[model samples]
Target: MNILSQVTRIKNAIAEVLTGKDELVELTMIAIVNKGHLLLEDVPGTGKTVLAKSLARLIEGDFKRIQFTPDILPADITGIQFFHPKHQEFEMRPGPVMTNILLADEINRATPRAQSSLLEVMEERQVTIDGETLKLPSPFLVIATQNPIESHGTFPLPEAQLDRFFMKLPSGYPDFHQEKEMLHMYRTKNPQDTLKPVFSLEDILVMQQEVQETRVSDEVENYLLSVVQATRSHEFIENGISPRGTLAFMRAAQGAAYIQGRAFVKPDDVQFVAPYVLAHRLVLTMEGTMRKTKEQVLKEILESINVPVESEAGR
Candidate 1:
C-alpha cells in the first residue's frame, strides 16, 4: 500500500475504539515517523490510556505500562542487576521500558529520581544497569500522561525535562456526540482487544526516511524562523524556542506535508504542526502566565507573521 493508504488504515484502526480524536491519532503517527515522544496532559477516564494502548496494538509493538508513584524507585524502571545465588553469578534483568511502546501513566506522581531515570532512555534509546548498557528495542516511543486537574502529591515536570518531549497534548475532553458514540461503541466490547497491526515496524522506518527527505524551500524556511524569532522577543515571553525546538519544528512540518501526499513543505504544513511542536517548549513570563496561556501566546506569534505564498514556499 502507499503511504496515504497506510496512514488511513492506521487511523481507522484506532477509530474503532476512539472517537473524535483524529488529530490526536494523526499527530501520534507523525511523532512515530519523526522519531519523537509525546506527553499528554488530561484528567483520568478521557481515553488517554486507551489511545496509547490502542496504538501499540495497531502497530503490533510490545506494550508496557508503568503507573508511576511516589515510592517507585529508579532501578524499578531501568532494571536491576541481582546476584543469582543458585548460579553463583549476577543476572541482568530488563524493565518494562524494554518494550516498543511504553505508557508512563501519571508520570508526575513519581519522585524526581524515578522520573529522571527515563531522560537518558528517552533521548539515547538505551539504559544502563550496573555499569552495563542495554539498547532499547526498535521504534521505542514513550507516551507519558499526567492529570492536569490535580496538584496534590504530584511533582510537576521542570522546564529542562519538559523540553525533552517532542510534543505535548492537552488531550481535550470529548464533545457530546463523540462521547455518546464512544459510550455506544464500548458498550459492546473493547474494540482494541480485537485489534491487529496494520503496518510493520519496517514500514514505519521506511516512512521515516521518506518524511525526512521532504523538501523545505527557502521562503518557508524564513517564515518558520520568523515565528521562532518572535517567540524569543515577545514581550510576554521569558524564554523562547531553542535550537533543538527549531529543528523539531522544521521536521514536524516535513512530516505534515508528507502525510498530505506532498513532496514539499508548505506554509500551511508549518502552521498546522506549529502549535503541537512549539507550545510545550515555550516559557511565559509571570505576567504572561497570568494574562495568557502558552497556546494563546503561540497563536499570537503565528498571527503576527505572514505565511509565505505557495509559489514562494515551493512550486
Candidate 2:
C-alpha cells in the first residue's frame, strides 16, 4: 500500500550495486511494476545485465538469461518438445522465457526468425510448445539489452520488434565521483552477493495492480494525446508513436505517479516519462537524423505543448 516506501527500498537496494545510476534504476522499476518490457541500448559495460539480475533478486523472483547469437534458434529460447525413448512418449521442455525475469542479452545478435520467437511470450506471457501452451511465471518481465556501438554480426531490430518494448534507455556511463565510488564498492565485495529482496513477487503483483489505479485526469489525458499527435505530424519524424505507444505513454505517466507515491497523475508526471516512452518509438526522417537526435526533437515537441494547471490535475 505504501508505494513510496516500497519503491524507495527497491531503488536503494539496487543502488548499492549499481552506483551513480539512480535515474536508470527508477525508470527500470517503473517499467517492471507496469509489467512492461525494457530495451536497454548501452555500451558493453554499463551494467545492463546487472540491472536485470538486481531486479530479479529485489523481488525474490526467478532470473534466467540467454546470450543471443546468430545461431540461436526459436527452440533455443522457447524450448522444444523432445521424445523420450525410455518413456516411449514425447515431453515438453520450456525455455528461459518461463522465468520470472528474463534477460535476452545482445538481442540484436539473433536472426529475425529467432527474434520473432519472443513476440508471442512477451505479449501473452505464455509459450506454446508442440500444441501445448505453458504459462510463464507471475510478475514476468523481459529486460532485453543490446550493444549500441557494435554493428558487427548484429541484426537490427525491425520497427515492429522495437514496438514491443515499453521503453528504451541508454545506460550512460557513471560520473567521476560515481566511478571512483564503484571501484571501492567492488573492491570490498560484490554488493550483489549480499543483496536481499526488498519485496516479494506478491508485493510486485500488488504494485502492478495498484499502479494502474493511479488516476489520470482529462486535462493530462489531452496533454498526452497532444504529444502523440505531435510526433505524427512533426517534420523530422518519419513514423510517429503508434496507438499502442499512446497507451503506453499514459500508462507510464501513471506508473511515474505511483512511484512518486502520488494518488493522481499530473502534467509533470506525463512530462517526466515522455522521453523514455516515446523517443525510441519515433522514426526519424533523414533530415532529422542528420540534424538532431530523437530526444532532441521530442524535447522540441514537449516545449511546444501547453501543460495543464497542476491543481486541476488531481481532480
Candidate 3:
C-alpha cells in the first residue's frame, strides 16, 4: 500500500477503539512516522493506555508496558547485569524498553533516576548498561502517559526531559456522542481485542523513510523557522522552542504532508501540526501563564506570525 493508504488504514484501525479523536490519533500516527517519542498528558479514564495499546496492535509491533511508580528503579527499566554461576559471567537482562512500542504508564509517578534512565534510549535508541551499549529494537516508539490532574505522589518531569518528547498531546475526554457510541460498542465486550494490524513494522519503517524524502519547499522552511524564531522572541515565553524543537516541527510537517498524500509540504501543513509539535517545548512567562492557556498563547503566536508568500521574492 502507498504511504497515505497505510496511514489511513492505521488511523481507521486505532479509531475502532479511540472513537472520535481523529485529530489526536492522526498526530500520534505522525509522531510514529517521524520516528519520535510521544507524551500523552491528560486526566485519567481518557483512554491513554488504550490509545497506546491500539497503536501497538495496529502496527503489529512488539508492545511492552512499564508501569512507572515511586518504587520503580532505573535498573528495573534498563535492566541489570546479574552474576551467573553456570556461565561465570554476568548476564544482561533486557527491560520493557527493549520492545518496539513502549507504554510508560503514568510516567510522572517514577522518580527522577528511573525517568532519567529513559533519556538515552529515547534520544539515541540505545541503552548503556555497565558501560555496554545495547541497541533497542527497530522502529522504537515510546508512548508515555501522564496524569495532569494529580501531583501528590508524582515526580514532575524536568524541562529537559520534557523536551525529549517530540510532542505532548492531550487526549481529552470524548464528546457526548462519542462517549455514547463507545458505551454502545463496548457494552458486551472490549473493542481493543478486535483491533488488528493494518500495517507491519517494515511498512512503518518504509513510510518513515518516505516521509524524509517529502519535499519541504524553501518557503515552508522559512515559514517554519520564522515561527520558531518568533517563539524565542515572544515576550510571553520565558524560553521558546529549541533547535531540537525546530527540527521536530519540520519532521512533523513532513509527516503531515505524507499523511495527506503529498510529496511536498505546504504552509498549511506546518500550521496544522504546529501546536502539538511546539506547545510542550514552550515555557511561558509567569505573566503569560496567568493571562492565557498554552494553547491560547500558541494560537495567538501562529496568528501573529506572518507566512512567507514566496521563497525568493523577499530576497
The lDDT of each candidate is 0.89, 0.91, 0.86
lDDT of 1 by residue, 240-261 (tens): 9999999999999988888777
Candidate 3 Cα errors over 4 Å, as ranges: 85-89, 308-315
lDDT of 1: 0.89
Q: Alpha carbon lDDT of residue 154, candidate 2?
A: 93
Superposed model 2: Cα runs more than 4 Å off: none
Candidate 1 off by > 4 Å? none
The sequence of per-residue lDDT tens digits that candidate 3 reaches over residues 254-281 is 8988888888888888999998989888
| For model 1, the run of ten residues with the poorest summed lDDT | 1-10
- List all candidate RMSDs to the true structure: 1.1, 1.0, 2.3
- List the pairs of residues colliding in candidate 2: none
Q: Write the per-residue lDDT of candidate 2 for residues 255-313, one digit (tens) a residue.
A: 99889898889998899899999998999999999999999999999999999898876
How well does model 3 score by local distance difference test? 0.86
